[model samples]
Target: MSTEAKRPPVPSPSPSPAAAQKRKEKGTPGDNGADAARATELAPTTPGVRRELLHSMLLQRRFEERCAEAYALGKIGGFCHLYIGQEAISTGVMSMIRPDDYVITAYRDHGQALARGVNPRSVMAELFGRQDGCSGGKGGSMHIFDAKTNFLGGHGIVGGHVPIAAGVGFAIKYRRGNQVCVCFFGEAAVNIGAFHEALNLASLWDLPVIFIIENNRYGMGTAISRSTANEDVLVRAKGYRMDGESVDGQDVFAVRECMARAVERARKGKRPTLIEMRTYRFMGHSMSDAVSGTYRTKDELEENMKRDPILLLHNRIFEAGELTEGEMHKLDDEAKAIAQDAWDFADASPEPPLEKLYADVYADTSS
Candidate 1:
């Protein structure tokens, strides 16, 4: 078994383990009049909020699209999960949090880390396993971490980080700091035993953590229905007595609004909220399985693309005269340039030296 699968459930800082999950299940599942109206209603409206949101999503999109191409060419190693279609969830939620706030997520985390302000080059370098990578070339795609930004990790374990996030929330409460910890994971994680354990603890202790389930329909190659009995995963929250919600994951504004409320509640009283973002994955589970074999279909993929979050937000703003086609074109171009620079940096960056192999491998022996 892989090391990730062996993540022994360690004791969390909380009196008990913390956890939560969400998957947005209802929507027209199409990009049309009703869908457009829904998006408009949910969009964030403030000075430059729309533009910046678009920029953040665009950066993640372009970066991962290139990552797909690079993975096909064998640049990234280990299990590389892409966050292509789920861009809005990270972009919106991360935008709503304060600098002191914390973020912890499962392996599909490039977008969240970038949304939290990890430089494009550093992210790309990590994927390339270069010395300057965020995890210093030790952790490739599935282990990105940046303490300066409080992005706790890009954990490879499925439901492992759920409780760890609760621990962070407990520490925040212990310090009396009004900060929230947002834990991101896939729909499949809901089935893990550790998931329920964490959520129960989060509620019992009122740890300020938002358990975000980025339900992109399929839990890897298997659909949620195959493994989970409850289609609406938020129902799991009821057992813990914590309020839960399902949001339009593709609509950035909708996600931001939900995140804003959850962050406020956590910062104020350290209560945890469960949210499921209804979204889709344009790509397969990973670059290796780009098609997902017989699990998903081409027509279904085409249909979801109609409501592509990037285009949905762009068209909505342009139609309302909030932004022009020229402005959006410029933003898209800038994202591409940033991605190109990241590629260049990763290509030129050197590999980690052998001397540092055991540098951070073990616990410190110091007093």
Candidate 2:
């Protein structure tokens, strides 16, 4: 657990229940000093924004919950990774970016695509392998894509998309466009060759991209302490001489504040950043894997769930008077309904036809 072996110390803040309840009392928004600082930095988070955040996170949570059911019912196949606990990071970061901006991530991307405005119906259709899926039913849960929303497809390989994200950033710079590319990946990917290569090139060219490392403590089933010398992924940024920061990934306000700064730096100035978000997944690496304390202890799992991002945000909503309990419950119901509707729509949609087996595979040689 001591990262002093190879890298500088990076602070990883855990979730705080006290912070969510602090704003209701008096002078500051949250009890935690860091949380209060974040609240001030994002002071303009209005009632509408709060509602949207809650709604988006809830929808993601419920959708994944449904995915688990579908997978069990033999409706979906192949690798299916859920984003059940890491919703706040996606929701908060996506809210800060524009439609023109680009977004890309690794396979655990159902929530990321939805946050980027990809229709849940199409996403569910993709999961169900229906013809109307965003990827025409070819790409399953791991490869959901929607170019129309500027959300590049999710790659299956760990660091495969890192270089591609750098290329996207380069394209924006070449065209003199005011858009930033946000590349997301797990902490495990930081050890890969492509990750360092992409960071070095991006920093050298001053490309507009934010390299977000979602450090969920485990890469598949192995914890970070067992994998690499440096436990803190942000310290890797120091080698590339890129500005980097680590934050409490479970806290939405903290994530938003950190991401807001990264976005500004990418959009205005051509500066790339490396962000290490310390979050934890409530479930196992994948549905096929055992989540019942096989590699991790039951106590560890329960302790992390206590800081669930959706519950944290809900507590803040109740504390701040942004929305009444009844209204929040109504929003939660709406989110659940959306997920259910997606399932129904996906069920009704047709399957991919056999005739189009070679569709989009090869180009015309006659030209």
Candidate 3:
């Protein structure tokens, strides 16, 4: 990762109350007119970007919500991890990258995959384990891959994808391309050996890899305070002689700002940077985990909810007097319609043919 001097400080913006109210009601600011407009107004800070971030995040949240329901109804099988609250982290960071840039992450990857522009219908079909899935039904919720979009497969092993991310960065450097590789993992991954080894190699080669640790406070059931001696994940980068910093992952602007610097550094051929996003997950670790009060206290979850990223952005837009309530409703309706279309498509899609399982396996001689 690049050094601190190359990584600029992100500007902090105040949240608006109107945006908060909208977020509380709709789970996103883009669903509210004021919030969407405010996001548009701020587009100048990040050119050519409009309400897509909000729309994409909302799509992810809705898609995952449908998956949860499907899992319950037995329409989808296997371990399903919903990226409900962590939408901003992926959306904010991904907004800064180009289509050619690479993205790799762990099993909690639906949000990242969607943000990277994978077809929602294919993703949904994959969750349904259908032939139309991004992975042709071979990989489920934890393994979505779209080569055209440069989204690598979602790995299942804890911290297993770190080295793969570094390898992608090395490839980019060797090819002499300006592309950067983004490696997204959980805070628990820092304890794994892959994290250390990947960082060491990335730093030594000055590879353009950005290691983003989505520290949602818990590694499965264990909290950061319990699993590791140092809860500040960014501090670990010092050991590898790399630049690292912590950011408010819940805030879209904060994450976007941080990613902009990291992307710039990577494009400039600087070393990798380790960014620890201090965020939380509104849902359980997996579909098996309870969203209500179980592993964590209600108060603890409630406190985190107060800092909702969707609401913060919406309120800022409302306070700026940019959009109307009716407009926000239209956006929400559009997102719902899009999600519904994808679900319907997945429902109607056929499963993979039995022979296909053997066909794509390996090259063979004529019989």
Which rank order by TM-score, best down to worst? Answer: 2, 1, 3
Local accuracy of candidate 2 as per-residue lDDT tens digits, 1-367: 3223312111111124365555334433222555845565664487788789888988888788888888877888999998888998999889889999999999999999998899999999999999999999999998988999999988999999999999999999999998999999999999899999999999999999999999998999888999989886778999998999998888777888888889888988889999998888887798798774678998888777767787777776666667776677788789879999999999999999987678979887886
| Count of clashing residue pairs in every prediction | 9, 0, 6
Report the C-alpha lDDT of model 1 over 190-232, residue by residue, as the tens digit: 9998899999999999899999989887888888888889888
Clashing pairs in 3: 1-271, 1-272, 1-273, 2-271, 19-314, 19-315
lDDT tens digits by residue: candidate 3, 120-227 = 999999999998999998899999999989999799999889999999999998899999999999999999998999999999999999999999998888888889
- Best prediction by lDDT: 2
Q: Name the weakest run of 10 consecutive residues (lDDT summed) in model 2.
A: 6-15
Write down the RMSD of candidate 1 (Cα, Å).
Answer: 10.1
Candidate number with greatest TM-score: 2
